[model samples]
Target: MRIAELSRTTGVSAATIKYYVRAGLLPPGERTHANQVDYGPAHARRLRLVRALIEIGGMSITDAARVLEVLDGGDLSTWQAVGKAQYALDLRRTAGPGGDPVARAAVDELLARRGWQVFEENPARATLVEVCATLRQLGHDDFVGALDEYAEAVERVAAVDVAVVARQPSVEQTVEYVIVGTVLGDTVLAALRRLAQEHLSRNAFG
Candidate 1:
């Protein structure tokens, strides 16, 4: 398809598509003529991914570009790519909410106790510690006390994800699936969490 078809089909403006191409977020389509470019399904998919990172994940162009760099060059397994995407979209990596000794120690202890080793660059570590610090600051020690339970639940979800990934027929498809899941699954999870919380809160308080 041509750029127009790609733009219309993806609901991405032609100008913005051009911008993405220039930004290296989307690859240049195959040039068919002096002024025409042909884009395939892969281009369409990548355009969607770029938009998802910017619109849904709240990632800056630079950060989205960096995440794509990992996708292209990291040679990571499906699970590893998915893991890195989670950390890449986090707002904390640039300037985290900061960590005092207590909160930092708790994060360290949580990781150690859970027997999970995450990348040193994962922004979630700092973000989690910051949340713990704020919880302690706000006298919400009980919420902070639920870290182990939360980690357990998260691990179960991770296990299910691994099972799902195992069913992918090819490594290429699996990697693409992970990227799509990483970008959009977060929104799906957050929306569901909100609805669940609302339903539970109404039952408890009303």
Candidate 2:
């Protein structure tokens, strides 16, 4: 398809598509002439993925580019990419107004209170700790007390995930399932929790 058709199909602007092509985020289209070019389905897919990383995943261009590199290599499991994307989104969201001493101290205190053994050197860990800080700012201290329970729940979930993955024959398949499962499992568990809560409520009321 021509650039115009590519733009129309992908809902990305022609100029933006050209920029992506220049950035190597999207592959260069075949040159029909000195001024004209044609794109293929791969270009459309790449553009869509780029938009998803930026708009839905909330990743910065640099971070998105790195993720795109990982995805292009196709060596890592899908779960790894999902985890990295989640971590990136968290970092972007918790960036915290760039150096407010009071907020920084509050976040540190929250992490300390929660007994979160975070390595200061690891930005990702710091980002997670900052989420705790954000929660504190929002006046939700329930997580502080529920840390142990949450940790136990996570352990249980991890064990179940491992058992399921163990049934897969190859490492690649296991990784792919883990990646896809990481996202789907969260949704599944959340729905199940609601159902269980409803059942318990009815039983208690009965």
Candidate 3:
């Protein structure tokens, strides 16, 4: 297909598609003639993936490009590639090492209690610590009492995610599943949570 057709199919502007090609987020199409470039289904898929990363995932073009590179490259193991992409997708501003010690201690205890072998430098560690501290500051420290429940639910969700990704036949497909599942899945999960909360609240209050 031509660029216009690709644009129509993707709901992305032709100018933005050109920009993505130039930015290395989407690969250039085949030059069919002097002024004609032809895109295939692969191009269409990639364009959608790029838009999902940038628009839905709220990633900058640079980060999206980096993730594409990681996915396309054979240098990294599947675990490493997916981890890099997941790390890049984390948009939260981590409260660095100097965050509240009480919160850090709580996080440490949670990790220990859960037997999670996460690296100390994982950005989520700091994010969790920051959240705990903020809750405490707001006199909602009891929120952490439900951390185990949240963790258990998350573990089940993670299991489902892993099972789906594991079914992919290739490393590239696996990485794509991970990226899409993490970025878009987050929105899906949040929306479901909101609906569930409303339903439960109505049941309890009615």
Candidate 4:
């Protein structure tokens, strides 16, 4: 297929596809002639993934490029690539680890109690501390009290996520599934949560 066909198939513009190639987000196609390049299904898949990372995942082009680089280069295993990609997309890493000490202790306690073998430097630990601290500041003790429930719910969700990703047959497909599933899955989960809240609210308050 040509660039136009690739673009049409992926719903990305030809200009944007060219830009992605130039930006190193997508690889250059095979040169067929002096002015003709032939793109394959791999190119189409990559273009769609690029668009998903940027447009759906809310990742900047630079971040998306970094993730693609991690996936494309090195001999990392599929899970390792997925872990690195998740780290690359973790915006919380850019936030300094200066959250409340009390909240941090609580989060640490929660992790230890659950026996989760998360890395100490995981940015999400700090994010959890920050959220707990903010909730405390706002006097939302009742909401904060549900931390265990929230953790349990998310654990189940994570299980489902991994189960779905495990069905992919190839390493490339598995990594891509992780990237796309996790990024867009957050959005899907949030939307479903909102709908559930609304339904429950209506039932309870009516």
Candidates ranked, most accurate by TM-score first: 3, 4, 1, 2
| Pairs that clash in candidate 3 | none
Off by over 4 Å in 4: 93-97
Clashing pairs in 4: none
- Top candidate (lDDT): 3
lDDT of all predictions:
0.81, 0.66, 0.84, 0.83
Q: Which stretches of candidate 1 lie over 4 Å from their true place?
A: 74-94, 119-121
Backbone clashes in model 4: 0
lDDT of 3: 0.84
Clash tally, candidates in order: 0, 1, 0, 0
> What TM-score, over all chains together, does every model reach?
0.85, 0.56, 0.89, 0.88
Question: Candidate 4 on 1-206: residue-level lDDT in tens?
Answer: 99889988999999999999999999999999999999999999888888888888788888889878877775778778767766765655355555688888888888887788898766667778887888888999788788888988999999998898889887777777777888889889999999999999998997
- Can you write out model 1's per-residue Cα lDDT over 87-124, one digit (the tens) per residue? 65575644645758899999899999999988767877
lDDT string for model 2 (53-168, tens) is: 66654457776665455445555555565454344333445355435455456556656765666555545555545666666678887875465577666668878987897687
- Give model 3's TM-score versus the native structure: 0.89
Error of 1 at 16 (Å): 0.3
lDDT score of residue 64 within candidate 2? 62
